[model samples]
Target chain A: MTMYNQTTDERVDKALANSFLRQATRRATDRLRNNKYKASAELGNWEEWRAAGEAIRKNVISNLDYYLNQLIEQMEKRGVHVHLAKTPADAVTVVRNIVSEHNAKNVLKSKSMISEEIHLNHALEEDGIDVVETDLGEYIIQIAGEPPSHIIVPAMHKTRQQVADLFEPIAGHALSSDTPTLTRFVRTQMREKFLRGDIGITGCNFAVASTGSIVMVTNEGNGRMVSTLPRVQITLMGMERIVPSFRELDILLNLLARSATGQRFSSYTTILTPPKNTADPDGPEEYHLVILDHNRSEILGDKLFRSSLNCIRCGACFNVCPVYRQLGGHAYGSVYSGPIGSVITPLLEKDWKKWGHLPYFSSLCGACSEACPVRIPLHDLLVKLRMRKTQSGHTPQVERQIFKAYRYFFTREKTLRRALRLGAHLQRPFVRNQRITGGPPPLSNWTNSRTLPMVAPKPFMQLWADLKNKR
Target chain B: MSNTSDFISNLAAKLGRPTPTQPPPQVKLSVPQYQLSSSAERVSVFLQNWQALGGKGAIVRSEDETLQCLKQWFGEQPITWFKENSKALLAWDKLPTIAESAFSSLNWPLTRYSQSAFDPRDRYSIAASAELGITGSDWGISLSGTVVVKSDPLRGRAISLLPPRHLSFIESTKIQDNLFNVLEEVAALGSPPAAIEMISGPSRTSDIEMDLSIGVHGPIEVYVIVIDH
Candidate 1:
């Protein structure tokens, strides 16, 4: 699995301690929030559009077998070879075979999150094929030997100075920490890799089932370059990335662009059919489309969490998520982080022993669902995941026992009144500034992280006596 | 790569649905309509949007005017163009020279085709030496200031992408009311073009400190010549 080296809590603690990372995340997300607000405000009826997007996604997922087969048939007619992978390992082997067929040593890529989910880069490098990331941000992180922190902006965690540092070594000289200067260097450097790459690989933003084409949107031209320059073009996409028609694609495109970057449209949006036809030139000769199911099929059966697949990977949920804003992307210990990641990670991996902690990462604030372009109920899904985890007996014994005692005392009025009367006296030692600053054992643990107002000793009775005496 | 049958069955079983061979009809609803009223109004919206998107353009009345303005824009300066005689790209009668240079003249260190040899890079050299790339738009979207280009043997994808400045010719009639209008047209095609490229503005990214930087990978400057009939 391509995840963080540390456990979720330890990673979050480390991220929180890094004041620079926290500051950067806060500044970036705040700006993103304002921009998204402005963009959606300009386009009237954004909510209606979101609802339609959600409906389109649901309709497509329910009829996925029909739509995907339709897409494959049309694609085959257009001369595109299609592959279906039941597992990540199977997907990797399918891609490996394509690379092997070309005797490909040089590979260029556009950013694909699904590829990261399968750890495609490592597999290829292990096979002795060199892979170059074409997008400017992706290239920086690739050379830095790190996965993307944010989906849209991969190097969001890195400062310009760090980017300069990363590039200077590659350039074999010193460079300035200026944005324009850094961007120029990357453009010049990656242009060579884009042109020379023998095989080009990308992730599909949305595959149009009606038209048998794949759509990609990017700010930089790397998406165009990789798909155009190489002799072979391969797009590895999740099985669910299908839109029925151009009409649906239009609305989804608007939703994705507005929710992702607060733009009316991205700088570049391309619709590519087959690699090349007999009449065309200067494009790939062979095209391959791989659809990976890899645990997503199980999600289609889940009633409460099935809508989690409606995500367009906009990263808006990350920007608005309170927990994600605090811990940053690295703390989630997965390729995907934030509310969506929390719901999908455990469900995908099925190793609740390891990834169960993720579902609890959110505050249940419902901000993620509000920010979601497709209106997925991420908070509700998180709660359901937690319930499932507890039912599986994963809840710690001490916490379960504490809750059991609270249930007992709360069920009996006499026991509750007596417990409160005694607890008021016991809480005196921990009270400071009218709040509980310290307590004993488990009580102390709660006080250390949170401040609870001490229960006032019979304040209600005192108030009633004062009113009666005045009257 | 087992047939999609197994994958489809697995998903259908999970979703508790019968295996469907054909998709259901699209659900129609009272979708909100968005449109631009007049060509003049659209032109105004397009130019305003063009500037906001970090692109520049000039509205011309005829192809001759477009050529004249383009000539005026790049007076006596050398340019690189794809096959210039196509109706899409107006023929140049007496323009600056064109280069058929191999990848050798370019400073890139890598080559995708077997025909070009690998060479070392020069830190100061640019990928495309010419300052301008000229192409034609098959259609335009006034709402978003997007020009759609189709790539083929003569019109390579690199022509519009590699240059620091890109010059695109758009027929005024080709300008649609909005992106929906554009997609509808594209969908109507019997068989869509191999590649359809939509250039909204100069390439940009805000990855570094959230600063807006334009022309990172493609043209830093773009000029759309709207040719009115």
Candidate 2:
């Protein structure tokens, strides 16, 4: 009954049938891609920026232990409490304990993928604590009782009318299906929560080691409010999210903002070294950073997959991914989605039997790798994941057999020609207007969604031979 | 209170190395240097980029012109929420003396964090209730059109964050070519401040069907007045 319980096939079928979802995703993704292109072009020297970003991330990840220790020392020195979580349950336990200690009745959260990864909201709600999602996109999906459909734009699947429908009941009046009116309602609603909420939770975009600062890049300013208003603040960080210093942050942030939202900077990029000074009038009285290491070390152990951790979660890959353009994020059936998601989900989650199929979600077009600001070779990794899945004997029997037959016939020219001739004859009954619309079980899967081109009447090799004779 | 030893040591083990005691020597990469010749160029770039981000800005010769500019700008505003008279504006104590004097000379309302008579213990309630906030910025990044505001004893973080509109004074000399230069200056200081907010423009989001909406949680309108010292 939970969010990710559906099988991959079921989710893909459901997503494919939703026309509104398709339209919304296409419009949003197209605009995001165009904006990012313009912004990066305006910045000029984008490739050099990407190279510098890659270098910085590569350095921190290679020497992760050193930088993490440095970050911990600096944070503690600034009077911020730090906790380590070895598992998802451990992370949830730490957050739950923090809430219980404060006797907090209401909790406010900004957009954090790590919180979703650990299912922190459900854990708190189970204890009868009210958890409010403060980001506009996150708030929309939160009320709809759904998981985020996109990484940055969480409610990308919902239209303006859908959002208005969700808020009208809560507002106790009729509402207009307009962006300004809907946004104003949420602003009025969240302002009260920001003032009175007992504890605030946010994800760290980049943790600077030398200064012990947790950076949050947000357009909506919810991140600022979350860190500033609550008496206590909790930051959830995946362990690999670190930079050596602010010098490196400058480089990565240049790439991040342009790649994520195509802005020079998000409206508010706040660097907080928390547990404020005693003389300061605003900010958290107690600050806690929970560093979670849920299967990231295992990813770090594999040299091929180590670079995946270098992702800044900008969601640029999602915009350019061809597979994601059609299927959207929900079909991936996980917290992370798109190319980055496909590469990391199976490696991070324990249920390989379910998550193993995620790697096959890509068309291997290499657009994700091209779009990556930190330069993760996502398509190459997807191919590698497919190899790993096959090595583990997790691929479907039909697919394995199909590949086996393909390998057998493709090795010899004569046999391939004979097979092609056989296919041409066999496809005749199914072909309608030069397209194969229906076939047996395995072929039916392909034909059900889209048409397969009928085999050539005369094989190309034979036609080439005849042309050579005529010349 | 869980220790990081196990967590960090496991990562060290995975990397086939012992836990490091010191930070690694970083490979120096060349950053893109956005070179501008003069302070005038920097201020002009800042103003241009600031307006592109939907912020209003003006360059003034002195603090006296800044006061005059504020008076004229407020007078021209279509919104009446900030001008209704009693304690509607909050300003940082670190702002130049002209700000305090402008309140009396222009008969405008202003309150500081500590001096708020509303609630002594929770004086930030004044920040929460105020319609407008005015403060002095530490630095302005001309390349990104960002104003850096660092919180201190006299400057409350809420003053820049809690209000519906924010107005900040940035000395033209404080404008820099890029964020890297500002970070370098911050690093030169021994200890960083509690919080450093780099405000690029008014709070904004395009979440509702990708329609851009201003001021979701923070200030809807932000004005940057660059003073020539």
Candidate 3:
């Protein structure tokens, strides 16, 4: 699989060049956006529901330790083994230890962002364990050896024809772009893997503190198969993913479905408690929950940024983001992408230089904040990250000098007017039809794709002054 | 650490958040009431909505009709059947024809005690690889076309989820007007049972390449038998 921790620029360039990826993303996002509109409108009191969901998430995060302890106690009572990991390494070690004890060779995974966060698939594959992602989107991306471009729709960037072409060689059959034919082929191929899998790995959506149940909402049945058929089941969850009770769960579910797919509810909402009794025929014999802190605890402690942990991974912010609309999730380079990713990735990783550019990718339109179901101030967080970056002296020297000059010019109206007049005269060489078509190295990147309006001939302030004098 | 009060106090102090003053107000939970025009009309409206959501439903008047429906459905598809150990099911004597391995007579009270007893996937297919699951629903919501089943020792959650096709036998008397009405009824039962599942239709998703795939996560085909006994 492609490493998302690096190669943000390369992926973004590739995604931009691939016409099919851009078209498919636009089409799918449009449909999802429409569905969300219809579903949320139908529900009535959607804002109220969003508020309740936000409040519940905020409350849970503030008292996360208490909830975690309560969840562990309740889960243990239900015969589930719970392990808490302070970091990604700790989480991997805990999972590796379990796999070693079980001697598991084959593992089936449901789509989980946390697993993606720690690069669990590579870790398992390195150990010679065959880990198969059972969700169709994850499966397609898994086979192609790429990280998910979109959280909800992992392979949204790929077209059906591309998927057919990809699967044809692997399945040793002529595959078609037809939906039913492709699905049937995948179902047949995955059936064997499901039945034979020694361990089922999944991501936890919400860990119910009251019942100690791991709540998973899926549109596909692979989660059920993975959880049931395998003797051992492992769930990796971010520490912040907890809800107080099922009652609160109802409110969140309503908001999540509407925000994610515009459905009243997902096709399947599975809550698996421990295998109830030996006499009970189905469910995993052993259930293991790996709760990974992996930077969330620190995020939880930060008063200004603590609200970021309240994100439910719905990808609603990504959908409505103007910058994300032009450039997909791959551009963000982190496992968590889009506006939330900008806030999350830098905080999660120690390598600041690699992920530091991510926060600046946004235009800070506040669309992400408006779209955020949990009411996270994503745009504000982006600005804060920029401030932090600047304060830490991470900004490039040339850019810093340019911005310092801009500050001086903007502070004085005379200097600003003179600078604007000088810029208009200097643009004479590049101006074509009153638009700057070419410029110096850095400015060329902006002018090549888009026309830079010629410093607005006469400046708005000058025009207003002329109008006042004429009156 | 050994003392429960000390554990609570220390834990509360560590988080630096105030402990609840009086044990967090007993969550004031209430199920909103929705009124329907009439029972018969409600059932019709429910059936329409169910059919609109791509689900199939049929009304059976008697036990004989129920058996006939089951036999016809099984005759069409490869299936293995398991019967609940309830007196009502036993009176029908539907067990003799199926192979001993195919049909097991479960203990009724024990099955009822455990929420997962009726789970359909537990029994290996008796006649053929089981593709269709058969069960009796505890209640039905006509407005939402939802079937509400309480998980008990006798009833398995898998019975509803595992198979590609699910056939539920629910009574007409149990059909409620709306989801709210069903929630109210459930609340009246006191301290909601261990599990209460509201299944609408076959499991589905449009996640894979944005193509709608039925039975992706849950049963693809769900059939509801509304019996008037």
TM-score of chain A of each: 0.94, 0.94, 0.92
Q: iRMS of each prediction in angstroms?
A: 3.6, 1.5, 5.0
Candidate 1 residue-wise lDDT, B125-197, digit = tens: 2225445666668888877888898766545566577657887767677888677888888899856788999
Output the lDDT of residue A118, model 3: 87
Q: Please give, for residues A353-375, the per-residue lDDT of candidate 1 as tens digits.
A: 88888888999999999999899
> Candidate 3 on A1-471: residue-level lDDT in tens?
555555766867876887766777777777777888787776666676677777888788767766777778777776778787767888888888889899999999998998888888889889999999999989888888888888899888777888899889979979878877788787768766776788899998887776677778777767767776677889998878888776677667667877998865565656666654565444577888888877665676567688889999888887887767777777677788888988998888856688888888899889889878788999999999888788878887778887998899999999899989988889899999988998896778688789888887799889999999999
**Residue lDDT tens for model 2, A252-346:** 88888989988888899998888888777778889999999899989999998899999999999999998888988899988899899999989
Score residue B83 of candidate 1 by CA lDDT. 33
Clashing pairs in 1: A196-B111
lDDT of 2 by residue, B73-178 (tens): 7874423655563557787765766566665576665777656643332565677778789899999999999999998978888888887889998889999999
Candidate 1 Cα misplacement greater than 4 A, ranges: A1-3, A455-471, B79-130
Candidate 3 segments exceeding 4 Å error: A3-7, A412-421, A455-471, B1-46, B68-128, B138-144, B148-153, B172-198, B216-218
In candidate 3, position A191 carries an lDDT of 67
Error of 1 at A454 (Å): 2.9
Docking tier of model 3: it is acceptable
Per candidate, native contacts kept equal: 0.64, 0.81, 0.19
Candidate with more favorable, higher lDDT: 2 or 3: 2
Residue A283, model 2: lDDT of: 82
**What C-alpha lDDT, on a 0 to 100 scale, does residue B153 get in candidate 3?**
50
